[model samples]
Target: MDASSATAGRTGRATDAASRRRPLIDLADRRALLACRPDDAEVTEAGRRLKEAALLDFGIKESVVAAWLYAKCHYQIPTTAVETAAVVAGGDGTCLLLYNPGFFTEIGLGGVRFVLFHEARHLIHRHLYAEPELRADPVFTLAAEVAINHVATQRLGQGLPTREVPDGRGGVTTERVGIDPREIHRSYRADLREQGLEPLGYDDFVLTDLTIYGELRRMRNPPVPPPQLCVHLAPDGEGPALDDETVGRVVEDALTETMRAALRSGGLARDEMLGLADRSESGGERLGRMWGRLGLAALRGETQKTRRVEWWKRWLSDTLASKLREGERLVYPKKQGAVLLALGHEPMLSRRGPERTKVVVVALDTSGSMPDRVVDWLTTLVGRTDGVESHWLSFDGAVMPFVPGERVAGGGGTNFGHVVDYVEGRLEVDGKRFEETADAVIMVTDGYAPAVTPQRPDRWIWLITDGGDDWPERHDPPMACHRVTTGDS
Candidate 1:
């Protein structure tokens, strides 16, 4: 039997291991088939070629990020399900790359690489900018396509994909190129001119995806239409269900693996990975947190001045709030008091009761490891929180009460057990006991000391410095632990 027929016969049926190992069919004819429903033979041929192109073309040096992303995706299914291609969250908590075989064949190898890279980018972009409001804007949708295509063209060195179309005469002509950011900018300029409004220059127009969307919004009438070919962007597009949670998990895992590989290789791939992290820093909270975990600032050679409100700070603040708000209740004035207040006699007040003051213990390991900047930031956050009593302790082998900006001399072995004893009211500092139970205990350390479980483990949050052992995470019952980028590492 022919290769195509043999492959077709096994399509809707399960196959043994031996059958699966057979070689894929090679297309005898490479011409684009125009039939609405191509024969099984043609479909099988197209699928085989498409698979070959992705495995061979995308795995080259030129396409580092794309190659890594494609490798991370567990499944690549070929069918007539999608018009071109799409990356969607699969039911089994993985990402699936769905493509139409005919569409892949029509665009050829260069186009296949372009489309694959484009789809991979779409997955990353979706994971980074997951804000619902951002996705809802039509301008933002167009801006994403422009930004993605722009980067793809630059990296792939393939300007754009062109498809062959039937001319009025018998011969075929090449037409229908991919989305061009420059062309869209020109349209915006023309629209602005017609409306007697000033348009941004090409450089400003294509700075970033958000910048593009913001500039497009200023136009009286947006010149560029929404992307029609993007299946994920279309509200009614058909395919497997795209789960946000699954997408986030898969993308995060893929990026983590890619970043590790780049770090080990340390070449063009590493540089490209760093660039990706820098560009995505402004995307959203999830992306920012992931980058922080990956030590983006350290890789980029950034210093203290370049640091902004990092993800760890936000996470710490939120965690403190949650811990402090526990068991708190709102107290309202009685009905009679409410009536009198309504009549302008007095104003009724509703306040959080049982709120003497929330106690927070912030212990910094001053064994010459903790960053001063982190200590300063933590002080500001804890000091500014209302109705909270703060205690600052600097500990190496022993604990000492010290205010922010007060330098405590240190050079000794680290002992987390001492800090725990003080916070749990077992040990005294300066001949005074910690009378109140701490609502939250934040420990900033290099994680060099032995792991010790606190009395109130739920209230403890550990911030381990870069290259430090995060032993708290592997304790009997893991505590909330996060790595803080020190920039030096």
Candidate 2:
């Protein structure tokens, strides 16, 4: 041989030797792999080479490669004796032979090569790493089919022919490719055979179906409905009547199983999954037991007992309690009366509004930065009070007064000083008819604005939120500001 030919021959032999020394059934040197004696030395040699090449090409480690091969040889291959053969003459040229001896013609290495290439595509796609079978198998097959066809077209100059077949009549025809879809499917099986890999028939089909169905279904079906969100109330009455937090939790739980399954199938990574946990302890029960912590259920006694007390106190007291004797009726009214009655005292009205009328003003940021949770909670709280006169105002560049029963939704840029100025301009010794100027001014925001001292000397409460571009300066505090971090606050 010439010098170049000698060097190429050495490289080929080295490659083959590397391929052969590697074990097919990795089984972690486990007992299962140790027990599978080769049918002969040639069987052992073939098994080793195939496993090595498969592991190297698929990018799976040898240990994993062995586990699968051991299972195939000891458990599956014996029952199906005919195996794929190959003839390698160096220069990356290897002929794949596929035959079962009894039912099918002995297919040339071209068919085998095509199938292996297709399966090789799946390995690169890394679909098998999921556990609990979260990933569909057909996804792999479909990916392989498309990839192999491309490869066949590129390397062999063999474009899959789109022939027009006669369709029951002389005049009409149907367009079909010369290659069968099943034959394309058979490629992956052949690829696995050449590599000493054999999964259970059911498992193979499952994976194949997952890939194929994903593609074909994509072609046939309309886009899947955006993941449905069914809102459920949290158990402790802390969250809104219907909330996203509850839905988010359910989605997290659903994906947890999928995450675990993906880890087992072989090539999947964990971080690709998103939103599997709460951003904050915002929704669900106060005690966090709703949905049994996975975000789903209700407590029977807790819900019913609380409802029963509220029912008689708020709804039934006037009709039912009037006829009863003083000590007989369970009439709980007013703030003190509510606390006392719950402590088993006779019902009374101590919790009722003070002898003087009370006025409360809510200065809400209609800024685009306010989260949906903040707006919903504020709306709920403002709606719940019965006796107090309430003023709701939202501002950005200017303060827009929102009277009770008027709908004021959140959305706009924030300018806190302007809002403060408006509050100042509107307030005087004699203002719009009211029993008292707002005793308390509650401001809800993500703290995104220029800091300003409020004109009114009322007590101020701030609802601070997550993620905004700006923050109020601590040196410029509003009147007696109290901070609340989440919706429950």
Assess every candidate by TM-score: 0.54, 0.26
lDDT of 2: 0.35
Which candidate ranks first by TM-score, i.e. highest? 1
Clashes of 1: 0
Over 1-489, each residue of candidate 2 has an lDDT whose tens digit, in order, gives: 000000001111211111233233322222333353333444344444443354343223212221222222222221011222111111222111211111111122233233333322222222122221322333433433443344334433444433222244654343322233444445545655655765234223323333443433333221221111100011222211112233223233333333322232313212222111121122224324322322111111123333222211121223222322344322345576557557874343211433323454677776645544544544444434344446777776556677645666655677777655555554332244323445455666667676766654434555454444323324444233223333222
Error (Å) of candidate 1 at residue 455 is 44
Off by over 4 Å in 1: 1-43, 224-228, 236-240, 284-286, 303-489
lDDT of 1 by residue, 63-168 (tens): 5666766676666666443456667675566666655565666666787787778877777777788887887677777788788887777777877776654454
Deviation from truth (RMSD, Å), model 1: 13.1
Give each model's clash number.
Answer: 0, 31
